[model samples]
Target: MPLFGRKKSEDPSALRWSREPLPPTPEPGPDGLRSMEDHRDYLLSCLTELPPFSQHLLDALDLSICEDVYSAIDMPRFDNSAMDGYAVRAVDVAAASAEHPVSLPVVGEVAAGQDALDRLSPGTAIKIMTGAPLPPAADAIVPYENTDRGASDVRVFAPSVVSQHVRYVGEDIRAGSQLFAAGAQLGPRDVGLLAAIGRDTVLVRPRPRVAVVSTGSELVEPGQELGHAHQIYDSNSTMLAAAAKAAGAQVYRVGLVSDDPESVLQVISDQLVRADLILSTGGVSQGDYDVVKAVLPQLGETDFTAVAMQPGKPQGFGLIGDDRVPMIMLPGNPVSAFVSFEAFVRPAIRKLMGVTPYTRPVVRCRATHDFGSAPGKRQLARGIVSLDADGGRLVELAGGHGSHLLGDLARANAIIVLGEDVTQVATGDDVDVWLLDEVS
Candidate 1:
C-alpha cells in the first residue's frame, strides 16, 4: 500500500519489478582453512600423474638380494672338492684316528682350478686342493691337519665320513627357478646375487626432472654483494634443488628471477618445456610485488591458491604451459618454502619419480609443552624427536614458530602436525609427527 500516495491501483505492474539474481558465489579453491586429513586427501588425488618406466633385475643393476629368490641356474656349477687334503674312500678311514692311524699310498695330487686325473683305488689316496674337482673313485676329503704326509703315502688320524667336504653340483641353485620377483629395489647384496647368476644389464625407471627457481628482485645470488636496502641472498633455489635430488629427481636450478611478469613468464615457459615438475619460491602472497600470483593466470588456468596451512599459506598450483607440466608456487620465506616442499611438493615429485606409497612416515609423540594453532588450518610445527623413558618416541617443539626462522628448521628432526579444530594442546598431549630423517 502506498501510504504517501496517490494512485495505488493505477500502476500495480510498475511496482512489481523483478529482482536481479545475486552473483554466483566464487567456486572454492585452496583458500580458506582446511583440515589436515582433507588436505592430505586432496594432495593424494591430485598427484596421480606419474612418469612411465620399466623395472629391471637387481643383478643387472648391480644391487643386492636382501630377499630370497629361487635359483634360476644350478649353483656350484660342478661337483668339486671342499678341502686341501687327501681324498680317499670312506671305508679306508672308517677306524682311522690318532690312536689307530691308517696309511695309504698317494696316487696323485689335484690342485684347485685343475681336474683330477687319477681315480683313487683301495689302499690308495689322492691329494686334493680346495675347490678342485673330486676324483670319481674318491668319496670323502680328509683335512691335512688330520693326516701325516709322506713322500708316497699319508696316514689319517681322523675318521672320514662319506661325501665329507664335497660340494655337489646344483646344491645351491637349481636350473629354471625364479631368482627374484619384480618391483624389488636393488641393493648392494642384490648386485652380488645378479652377478652370481650372470646378469649384465638392468632396466630402471628414469629419474624425474624437477626445475626450481627463486623469485623477487630483493633476492640476490649468494656470491653477489648484497644491496644495503632490503636485499637478501637467494637460498630457496639451492635448497629446493638439493632436496629434489635427494628425493631421486634430476634437479635443474633456474636461478633467481625478478618479481616481474615478463621475466617470470619467460622462465616458466622455458622450464615447462624440459621439466616434469617446476617449483618456484616467492611472489605468491597478496603483496603489491607478488608477481607469481599476477602472472600464473596469464600462463595457465590456476588449479588452486592459498592452501590452508601455515608458513606456506600463500601457495599456488597450476599448469605451466600448453604442455601442462605441473608447477607449484611457494612462499619466499626460507622456512615456509622448505615446509611447503616437505608437506606437499616432495610427495608429488616422489610420485613422478616412481616412488611407491609416496607419503612421509608419521609417528605418535608427546608434546613437551603446550601448543596453539589457528582454528580450521593445519599447522606443521618443527620439533626434535627423541626416545622417552618407556622407549616411546617423543617430539618437542623447536624454538620459535615464526615462518622466517630457518635456524629452527635446521635443528628440527620432525614436524608436529596440529589438525584443524585443535586450537590448543597441553604438555604431554599426544600429537602426530612426521619424521624428517630416516632414523633407525
Candidate 2:
C-alpha cells in the first residue's frame, strides 16, 4: 500500500510538489496501514537540502562543496632543488668522480626561500639547500654527499644528470585548472590541498542542526533518584542525539518533556531558533497519554499514521513552527526509535546535508538460523552481520525479537529486514539487511 499521500506542505526554501491533483494512494494491505517505504519517501520528499555557506577550509572538513574550485596559482611556482645539493652544470660535473674528482670554486650558498639567482659560471658550483630556488642558468644538482662539505672550494666525486633533482614550475598542477568538483566532500588530504592552493575558505553545505526531544510523564534523568516504581530514566534523547551527530548533524539534546500539551508546545517552539530538523520520540500512538499527537497538529500540519512495521508501527511527521522546520515523531521504545531512525530520520538528515543515497546500504545475506516475524507487518530484527567462510554475507538475530529489548539492540551492529509477507526464515535462507555501520 502507498504510505505517502500527495504532498500539500509548503516550504519557501524547499522544492515544492505540484499543486495539480495527484494520483490516488496505492492499494492497501490487509491492515490498511501505509507501508514503511511509502512513509519514508514522504518524509524525504518534504525536506530540502540546507543552503550553502562560506566556511574556512578547516571548518569545511567533511562537508560537500557547493561550487567548483579552480587553482589560482601553479604548484611549484618556480624551479627549486628537490634536496640539499650543489647546483651545477651537468656537463661541468660529467667527468667528476671519486677516482678522478674535479675541483671547482663554490661561488655562493643558497638556502630555501632565497630568490637570488647568481648565474652558474662554467666549472663553478653553488651550494644549495633543499627547496632553494635554482639559479637562472643552472641545469642540474650534485648532492652535497657527492662533494666535500666545504664552505668555499669543493671537490665533486660524482657526475650529475641534467634536470635531475630539479622541480620545475607547474610540475604538479597548473593555474586555472579544476581543483575540486562541486559536491565533493572535504577530507584531510583535501584540506591540505586547499591550503597548498592558497584557499583559506570554501563554499559548502553546512551540517543540519537536529533537536532531539523525549516526552513521557514517567521519564526522569539518568542519574536522578526515581520518584516512583514505574519511572524510568530518559535515554531516548541522548541516544537519538548521538545518532544524529554520527549521521553528520549538529545535535541539541533536549531534556524530558512531560506528557502535557502546553509543555510540549513550548519546548518544541523554543527549539525553532537553532533546529533545522526536530526529532521527538513517544506519544504518537493511540493511547490516552498520546499528548504529542494531539498537541502537534495545533502548531503545524502534522499527521499520525500507522505504518505496517513490527517493533515500530506508529509514526508521525510534519513541518512545524513558524519557520517550518521538519519534525519526525518516533516510538518510545528504544529499539523502535532506533529502527525508525534507520528507516526515516537518518535519510532525512542526509538529505538536509545535501548527500546522495540517503538510505543505509542494504545487502543480500543468508540467515545463520531461523527467525519468526509478525504477520502483516515488516520487521526490523536486531542482529549481527558478518561474512561467512566463503566471504558471503551471514546474519543471526542478536536476541529475541522484542521492541523493548535495548540490550539486544546495543549488541546489534546490523538490522535484519523482513518484508511484510515473510513470516519465517530457515537456516541458509536468503535475507535482506541494512548495514548500520555504513550510515553514509
User: 42-97 in candidate 2: lDDT tens per residue?
Assistant: 88877888889899988888887899999999888899999797898999989988
CA lDDT of every candidate: 0.74, 0.85
Model 1, range 79-118, lDDT digits (tens) per residue? 7888889888999999998998999998888887887776
**lDDT of model 1, residue 174:** 80
Global lDDT for candidate 2? 0.85
Best by lDDT: 2
TM-score of each: 0.76, 0.84
Q: Please report how far candidate 2 places residue 41 from its true position, in Å.
A: 1.5
Tell me the number of clashing residue pairs for each predicted model: 12, 0
Candidate 2: TM-score?
A: 0.84
lDDT of 2 at 54: 92
